[model samples]
Target: MSLIQACVTAATTLLAVLIGGWLTVRTQDRLWRRDQERQWRDIRLNAYTDFIGAVREYVAFILNPAARITVVPRPRDPGDLMPFFDDVGSRYRERLESTKTALRLVAGRPEVVSVSAELVRQARLLAAARADSGVEALQADRFDALWEAERRFIETARADLGLPSAFVS
Candidate 1:
């Protein structure tokens, strides 16, 4: 080939290589970002599930009459019940706090974090009320409020993770 043709061929090849490299890098970057997003969603979902589970367990323990008796046998004096409440409440609170912290760290939206916080707050309130009085102290209003908080948290978390709502219109 002539000198000009050789230089033209070299330039064309160089251009093709540059374009190919750029495209490859762009595609790889996109894939990496997609993978990272999927991983984050998984983490957030796990955190949300864990937090919800902790709250449910805590509520169940507090509400179940058998659970209370199993934790600490009833004493002749009603005042002696404080120790039982303290023990069960503290253990459940620790689990809830740990899961809440994890949810906050991985939550994609502020709403999810706020709702989770509200749920935790409601759980704490219910625990306190039950501890101070007795299981009978768990009023319907407080129970409803706790359920509402949980519903909001679940909704927010579902939205954050791109999942459909549990309820239908």
Candidate 2:
């Protein structure tokens, strides 16, 4: 049309393109942030699961005599369990430690890491008790303490991951 109208149309088109580009960049940036957060949560969840699994396996091996038989040859004498305990206990402890390290690396909350330490401590206690006095010395309170520690760790990890507590009972 006229020179003024042409300039006005061109300016309006330029403004619209600039605004559209800015909105597109903003939306993409938001989406990228959300995707990164989801990936982080998944990584944390995997780490938490691995740590808990290691704890459970270690505890089960220590507390359940039958489980030990499946892992290693059963000792003829109860007193002969020392060697077995040393071997298996160290392996389990290593697994626990590695998993704990992974959890600590990914954990965003301090409580989860603290609770995991408590769980590891309880597992060690149970292993020590079993080693010193055999299964007979294994007390209900010791088992309860270990279980409670594990539960606390699970709850703390779940909260950190924004998941609802599954062990409310």
Please list the C-alpha lDDT of all candidates, in the order they appear: 0.80, 0.80
Question: Considering summed lDDT, which 10 consecutive residues are worst modelled in model 1?
Answer: 74-83
**Cα displacement (Å) at residue 22, model 2:** 1.0
The top-ranked prediction according to TM-score is 1
- For candidate 1, give the lDDT of residue 58: 83
TM-score of each predicted structure versus truth: 0.84, 0.83
Candidate 2 lDDT? 0.80
Native-referenced Cα lDDT, model 1: 0.80
**Where does the lowest 10-residue lDDT sum fall in candidate 2?**
66-75
**lDDT (10s digit) by residue, model 2, range 1-169:** 8999999999999999999999999999999999999999999999999998998888777866643322232355333222234555667768888999999999989998899988887776677667655676689998999889988988898899898988847
What is the per-residue lDDT of model 1 for residues 74-123, given as tens digits with 9 covering 90 to 100? 34533222223456556876787799899888899999989987887677
TM for candidate 2 is 0.83
lDDT of 1 at 77: 38
Clashes of each: 0, 0
